[model samples]
Target: MPDLSPAAFILLQGARVFAPDDLGICDVLLAGGKIIAIDSAIPADIVPDCQLVDLSGRWLCPGFIDQHVHLIGGGGEAGPTTRAPEVVLSRLTRAGITTVVGLLGTDSVTRHPESLLAKTRALNEEGITAWMLTGAYHVPSPTITGSVEKDVALIDRILGVKCAVADHRSAAPEKGQLASMAAQSRVGGLLGGKPGVTVCHMGSSKKGMQPLYDILETSDVPIGKLLPTHVNRSEYLFEQAIEFTRKGGVIDITSGIPEPIPPAQAIDRAVRAGVPLAQLTLSSDGNGSQPKFDEAGNLVGIGVAGFESLLETVVELVNGYRFTLPDALRPLTSSVAEFLGFDNKGAIAPGKDADLLVMTPDLVIDRVYARGRLMVKDGVACVKGTFE
Candidate 1:
């Protein structure tokens, strides 16, 4: 039976736990939104009213984290008529995402960063963990507090700043400018005890991944401090992205990319090229615009990104590409949590948040618990967004 109360005890027994590392048949105990015990005999001592779910054959894993999303939705690329509608909570939970990092995209003027911040808060209030980056594609990021450092350091929900490079739509920030942003983000994160990384949306352009390398060559900022996303969007960019990982920088490869091969194939290529598998992570880029352009640089078609593709990518990594369950899951789980300094998430360990998924052996999501609250049951959302 599912427990609807936030602070009620829930005991799950006889499940194969992939604490993201295959801890075989274990019993998990959750109380007050935290995992109180794992692989223990604590179930024998639970109170009578505790919700007991006997999972003799199901698999338990940490919930997925999507590190890049336009929570308030993104667009205005094709025009005002093309702006995407904001994401609702049920849409995310149904896709197995229990943690998300929201940000603005190319349309900062109409879709403000402050609105993104508020949406991040709404997701939290709706029963999932949420954080956001505090800038858009331009340098000198439009922030709630007038400066990147101030926004990141003072705002509890803000982890760092988001900016774009190597794209025609970007402001074409130089190496010095990027380094400066990274430095400020680092300082802000240090002050706020956050990750403080500058999340750069790598754009499709001739410059490729060179701007990050330029920043590395010219500045004292650490490679880890600069997290570049959309690395696998093009063959040239993917090749350079592999090199970036070799240089010890973490890169986010977007799922649902219009690529010749699946993202997992690219991951396999990276692994063969001696890149540490842990340095590569996955994000949905959900609710952002997928604009098609002609050679004349005009928008020809547009569509909205779906959260299901992120889940599909994980399944492909496991079933199609033959990645182990734990390996396939780490990028969307533990790795994202590690990158964002989310100590309480990404793993099914004692003292960690009880954000988890119950899955069938065939990789179907059966149930989802966010912060110990049962948000999804029987592959359908039992909870919904406020207006949904």
Candidate 2:
């Protein structure tokens, strides 16, 4: 059953509204976890029972969707104690992330796909939508079931497989192995009607995956299936990622690196390079461990990723980098939705989920709504996970 109520509440009067697709000045009618209408004004008769919120001229944009998150801890290179703990619900909600795609990082041995699936379901039960990738960085590829194909087809929340590519820390699959994995994921997606994306983790290493050129040369999967993340971490890597975009692949810029160049600058560089803004997406590798490796490839320093960086990226884009609000918001909002094949997310259209954020011109999140319910109001969360 779809939410067909005639806007139980109408948000009238916003100076600017980013419906995740474009910028406009219009009132949004929200009801029953879905956007019922977007019009100049609602009928007077429908106003009494509905809750009307006056925006006082603020920007309303679609809530953020983080694609490359370590949901249940993604460390272990340092030691057993270095593993990150499971992410808390309030951590994500307060950061304005209404949707997230979790993945396993280095320690797939200790943390199994079963644990990842359980954690995802738990988050979903708490009102935040959660999904996970099939495997970690290893070649054998750990799965809840023995096979990656089974995991993608049988597990409703499992979308695709993620591997470490072009990094010293990577399993570094040969060209043939990478193609076989992509074939398995593509066939599974076709069978289950799920996104068969092969999410790749690009690192700072200069020895890139020229091997993947084989899959690009011949494969039924569109280049978009290869979701290469963290492409903006290094200067050369960012250029490689831009070239990938030219080939129709979606590149994810991570917001968690503890480096000299910030995420906003990376985004600006991509824009100035003439990369399609729609082909780029941003994610806060939030709640994960950001390890700084010494020349010996050992962790010497570490920084924790902030859930708040998601919105902070928007602030830096608009304030520091001089990007228009619409330009800054598009990648984090609509671009992510399109990359992950989520039809109802990342938009404020009539039939889309009413997941939105209200913020001042200064980029402070004033309120948030997911599935058409008010979760945050006046910088505080009204709804929280049961675990919280």
Per-residue C-alpha lDDT of model 1 across residues 1-388, encoded as one tens digit per residue: 2334575788988889999999989999999999989974555566767888887789999999999988998888978999999999999999999999999999889988889888998889889999999989998788999988988899999999899999888988977888888788888999999899888898778798888888788888789888889888888888888888877899888885747546777777777788776787889899999887777778899999888877787788888888899988888988888878889999999999999999998889999999999999999999888899
* Cα-based TM-score, every candidate: 0.96, 0.93
Predicted model with the maximum TM-score: 1
| lDDT tens digits by residue: candidate 2, 30-137 | 777778788765553565676777886687888888887888988777888888888877678778878888989878878888998989998777666788899888
**What range of 10 consecutive residues in model 2 has the weakest lDDT sum?**
1-10
Each model's total of backbone clashes = 0, 1
Report RMSD for candidate 2.
3.0
- Candidate 2 — which residues are off by over 4 angstroms? 1-15, 21-23, 217-220, 258-260
The lDDT of each candidate is 0.87, 0.78
Question: What would the C-alpha RMSD of candidate 1 be, to one decimal place?
Answer: 2.0
User: On a 0 to 100 scale, what is the lDDT of residue 162 in model 1?
Assistant: 92
